[model samples]
Target chain A: MEASTSRLERDYRRVLRLLPAGYRRQWGDDMVGALLDAEQSAAAASAADEGPERQAEERDIALLQRPPLREVAGVAALAVRLHLASPSTAGATAAARLRGDAVRRVALVGLLAAAGPALLSAVTGLYWPVPPELEALGHTRVDALASALLALVAVAAFALFVTGRHRTASVLAVFAVVPDLRHPLETLASAWRVSPGTLLGAACWLLVLLAPLVALLAWRSDAPRPSRRWLLALPVVAALGWVPWLLWRATGALVAPDAAGSLALGAAACAVVALRRSDASWMRTAAVLAAVGGLGSLGQLSLLGYPPGLERDLGWTALGTVLLAAAVGVVAGVTGRRWSAQAAPTAVTAPDRSASDASA
Target chain B: MALTEPAVLVLTALVGETRHGYALIAGVEELSEGRTRLSVGTLYGLLDRLSSEGLIALDREERHQGRTRRYYRLTDDGAAALEAEAQRLAHLARAASARLRTARAV
Candidate 1:
């Protein structure tokens, strides 16, 4: 009986660890003690009617059946109750919430809406030839110049739309990605021998239809006051993802390059965005490493087939390398800054408690 | 068969009379011959679930032995459930005993 009581006490004590750190610090031991005392009293009363030896064996069996410490359901229920019971820790930022909701809704709708028309135009075989005046000037050069200009415009529109509530800019950004999205559908249709133009058109129509809904959500939302630096990181990350894709389009035929670098850069940029939004250091670090490795490999490969005696290719390679390195440094610095901001105060609070204890 | 040990004991404890939290805990402990003892939190959590399911109803609130307590009484559904479970267990025990006797004779 005594042995079983001791085992039950140990089990209960272990379970008490699931309580919040603050709650455990205050009342864990007391709760465990109360549970043990109750168990002991119950055992004593039960022992009165049973044979002494049988009672001891029964107690042993009962102790063996003690529940495990990690009760997932219990902890989940407690966590939900705690969260609902507590007031919003982010404080009175209803305006910020509204703004954030608006931006998120706009981005979601724009992305969903653009998916269709882009695919349709691609499928319908709408070949966008270089303008006649530009064609007379030089077909390849004019095409490249047109593409570069469109890329710049798209990037600018995306930046403006993300940074401020400019409805026109947002709409333009949505249209800008339309051409790019259509390119994939066109290729798919040509290969599969099926018409995907209607599907693409429908998708674009849906996006256009949903524009008002996105705008309304954005307008109605209380603008969330996330750190401006963190907010700025979003566009930077998006631009980083865009650069490799643009580069691929420009140099894909000439370079016949592996897509490994672009994938690495995109993943790294996503990690930076995620790190800024959440407290995940490992993912941020992984993103940085993947970006660096991918860019370094691509830069190395780009230099391999350079024309003899023309160091110009080397210069471009060096420039690309430098840009990639700069991106890694920027993302790491942001991640470090965010981590330190959250970590420093928690470190300082520990020593003050010991000093107070000594004084008491 | 689905009734948890705690739920069954709780229902058995309230078989004849309504009981509050502290009394229910005590009664369950006594009825189980102290084989199963539930903490106050566990008891309350189970009671809340049972009440929500309509198997048990809050009967009354009164001061008992200096502590305010809310008494719970099993519904007809709960009693019927307990009876069904008891019969199932009894049937299983009888079958097992018969099997053991047959094995010993063989």
Candidate 2:
């Protein structure tokens, strides 16, 4: 029994590692004490519910030596919530930690926002053929390198974020965006001379360019580090983000063919998957990134105008952009709130629930 | 404000006296008739929220048998919240009873 108890305790400690360092520092002991108390209570209750001779023999076995999977999943979800919600510092200096947390949060979000469109642009060279003035900047090696870096850094940053490298992801995201900031700013400065549509598009681009900096300042500390299993489906998701654009380019480049219905369908599919997941953080993030990326492309479309005579293509693209973005928002919000509600009481009765609802 | 089931149980546990994490776990089980069992992770999340909302406060900390036990108590805001919830539930119970009585008469 002593050996078994110690093993259980060790398992709990490993599970605790999913949480941020600062959170662990502050509440780790209390958390351990509560878990042990719960284990003890559960063991006693199970023993009382069983026959005496059987109880004496089975008490040790009843309390699992391994941490239950659902419990661990719930705790993982809590870790994400705490990471997003808690502002505990974990850097060498107070200011640095705050700054680091702030920058990382923004850069992460900015990274997500930029990633999909950036990938699509890189894959298809789907640059908006701007006015003759803008076209003068032509495709140069420097431009290609910047695009490559942007795409690589965004994916790497997202991969890092999903894999629990908080600061490194942030640094990568900031590094990716800083070089491109000047162009958006310069574009925005000429707002007075540009068309209204172009001005709106530039403003949106400026926001996209500036988001990471804002995110950097906005986050306090204790950014989220959810489970790495969240990234297991990254390739599929990355494909989903770009494949539609690819299909459009290949099949109907002149028309910018309708991906809106497909985008909505994809969002609905993501929502279905997310609904099945108790945490669904990964799904939510993926949906948000997809939506933001679509918006980015829409902004580019505005800058590109009607693309010769493809008025319908621009209209369809714009519609898909709005609907997909809205679909992600609606689905993410509903799923997030529902999961949050499920996280509470369900965590307590998890063992029984897991046996009944294996999908949970 | 409407509190979640765990938040309500936590407030009920801390309504009269201070209790530490282990004790609160026991208190909540008792309060909820054993239908709800809060995991440690859930408890702390609730505590974090309740504390930030000024509904609960840390009373003190103590070392017992090599374990640190930090005691928490319900604040005035917590007591008020609990009372309101109690009234709401009581009102619900009363209405159900009255409807049942009318149905019996019918």
Candidate 3:
């Protein structure tokens, strides 16, 4: 019985190692004790309802049993909460607030970037004169109307998100991603007939569509809502993001327009942070944008096989810009977070003497 | 803050008593009418959070059968919070019953 019990203890201790060293140091023994007691009680209860032979067999089985999967999952959940400095974690107010701010900014800026081109597309489709030749190719009034509505959903997602109607905005944002998925799905469906470059394009397209949704995890109940003043930036973003890219495309096909626009957006965000009081929040936002842009640039690789022309040139140009942005963004973000950690005042509470004595 | 179901059960179990980890788990299971079985990790996570929030505290500790056991108790704040939540639940139950009676009558 003693040997079996010791072996079980060793197994549990191994599992407990998944917890942080600090956490283990504080509560490891107590946890072990609790786990052992619970197991023993459960085993005893089961034995009570069994014959002597069955009871002996069950005891052997119980002695060899490991901690349950649910218990392991619960520990993992605690680890995530501790690592993220989630709001419920105690005495990590500064760290939690900083993390919350950074995540919130990423979501807001991502939606803003998405909203810009969408709004422009909707407006131009509604107001711009369709050339006779283009109309002859099969463009119809219904097609234009559908396009406009799609864009408007994206724009509404951004507007409602900034104004704090997050659940509705989330639904709208999900709907907005549907149109972007068409080309990607088409590419992926043709995988048997297409090059690996096309596959990369499909993956990148999916990533771009999903980035804002994934970043939406920032919207905890305690997350601060973006101020309404953010709405004023919409027009500016539309003008800056689309005008230069459109003009450049019109003159001569440059880099992938979306890639260049995303790189420029990331730069603009970084510049805003640089010009103001620098903080971890903006740096993290830049990091997220640059990471997304860098990954998105992979889509351009699909064009490299094109007969050496504008498409090929675009592939190379976009790839370089994104790579550079990602490298710089990562470095700056890590450094800024470290500096912020050093500067923030950490609160320290004395350990409970009674609890310590109990453990001893 | 609104308590999660498991948290509410734990708090209710701790009311008017100091209980060790296993005892608290049993107490919570009884309180929830066997509907909730809190694993060791989950119970500890709740205990850690509740302790930090000042709603619960380490009341004492003891050694049982060569293993150390720590006991937790509800603070005044915890009792007050639990009371408020219970009243809110009561109000909701009452309102629901009243509406059900009206609908049945119709």
Candidate 4:
């Protein structure tokens, strides 16, 4: 009987891994132990009515047969709810709770505001450029008008930033830059001297272009005070002081074997320093973008000007795509973690009327 | 009349009396002819959602047969909703069967 219980416990443990990491982290082991104990006790109680211990073993065996997947899913869901509502498990600071609410509201507003230009351009048919040689240039006029729309988005973003509407500012910043994704390779080549086929360039683009919006959205909305780490922006401002000199040096050494490479390395180092001094939310956002951009740059470089026999262009493309996918996944994971953290405090503080009513 | 499958099963199980977490799950399975069984997590998640919506209220907690159980009862609204849903389903089934018989005759 004990052996059968042990076997059932083992099977159940394997199924528990299907749960989310956070849920498993808090309750996985304890739940497994409790279920196993319950099974063993049930077996023991039924053992007396059976003719032999083998009959009790048979009953335990029947119970151990695979439970339906639906049952398991249901149990997992209940576990998550119980854990969420359990005050002892939530462990959220008051500041974090308030900040979380503020962040959600701010993020929603930013997302809505950022959609403005894109929505307007789509509606007015003014932003979609047509080929220059097209017979009917009137339709193409809309495409040319798109630049004005983009400019408006950029201006709105800058205004938001200046006015301390950071969330909306960040969203606008992203909206302003999204058109660049259409020609990511060209953008990298022109701005950073990195090829689109290389991992480093891709990483750089992601870090510099995509991460800030994600970070701003993730920032706690109701944090009682501004992050002290905002002070780090001063250092970033100072680092820009050396950009002109570095640019001059690079121009002089353009003929050097690794001059472009050195520039990439230097930019990455500066980004790291800037990130370290920023708020925790921004730091993570910047780090992810930088990492993606840097990798992309490298991938692009590896594919450029390759000798016919020596170069593998497809391999480089695959590498760049994988790196981009990974960076996106990392950003998504970070977003999810932020949301769960925000939700935790609310779940904990809310009354567990079900439990209380059951007791009464 | 728009109750989800899980909610319907839960209310059905609680039609006559209140039952705690494990018992409610077992009762649901039995009532469904073992077609619907809920895991602990899913059961609790639904329970929380149902309780929050005021469809089901927690009744009491006590040690029964050496195991602690939390009992729940269907609220008046919940019972009414369940009955309406059942009626709707029955009406649909009857209409479908009549259509099938007509088609068979043709």
Which 10-residue window of candidate 2 chain B scores lowest in summed lDDT? B45-54
lDDT of 2 by residue, A1-360 (tens): 134346667788889887767667667677777776667667666777677766655545544567667558757756655444434421122323333443343345454445644555555443543345545778655566566656777778777776777577668778877776776677778877877776666666555455444544333324556446645544554566656567767886443422233333444555556667644543554354445445554654552445555665665666666666676777677777666455432111011111221111
**TM-scores of chain B alone in all candidate structures, in the order given:** 0.91, 0.92, 0.96, 0.90
Between candidates 3 and 4, the one scoring higher on DockQ is 3
True contacts kept of each: 0.00, 0.33, 0.36, 0.27
In order of listing, the candidates' clash counts read: 18, 3, 0, 57
Candidates ranked by lDDT, best first? 3, 2, 4, 1
Candidate 1 Cα misplacement greater than 4 A, ranges: A1-360, B65-67
Provide the lDDT at A306 for model 4.
58
Interface RMSD of each: 17.5, 14.9, 6.0, 6.3
Deviation in Å, model 2, residue A315 alpha carbon: 22
Encode model 3's per-residue lDDT on A155-181: one tens digit a residue: 999999988898899889888887778
Highest-scoring model, TM-score: 3
Off by over 4 Å in 2: A1-5, A49-64, A86-360
For candidate 2 chain A, the 10 contiguous residues with the lowest summed lDDT are: A346-355
- Order the candidates by DockQ, highest first: 3, 4, 2, 1
DockQ of candidate 2, scored on C-alphas against the true complex (2 decimals):
0.12
Please write out the lDDT profile of model 4 over residues B1-106, one tens digit for every residue.
Answer: 2778888999899997987666776678788887886666566556656776667886776654343455689877677778899998899999999999999999
lDDT of 2 at A313: 63
- Worst lDDT window (10 residues) for model 1 chain A? A348-357
Deviation of model 1 at A336, angstroms: 27
Taking all chains together, each candidate's TM-score versus the true structure is 0.31, 0.45, 0.76, 0.42
Output the number of the lDDT-best candidate: 3
- Model 1 CA lDDT for position A40: 46
Candidate 2 versus the native: TM-score?
0.45
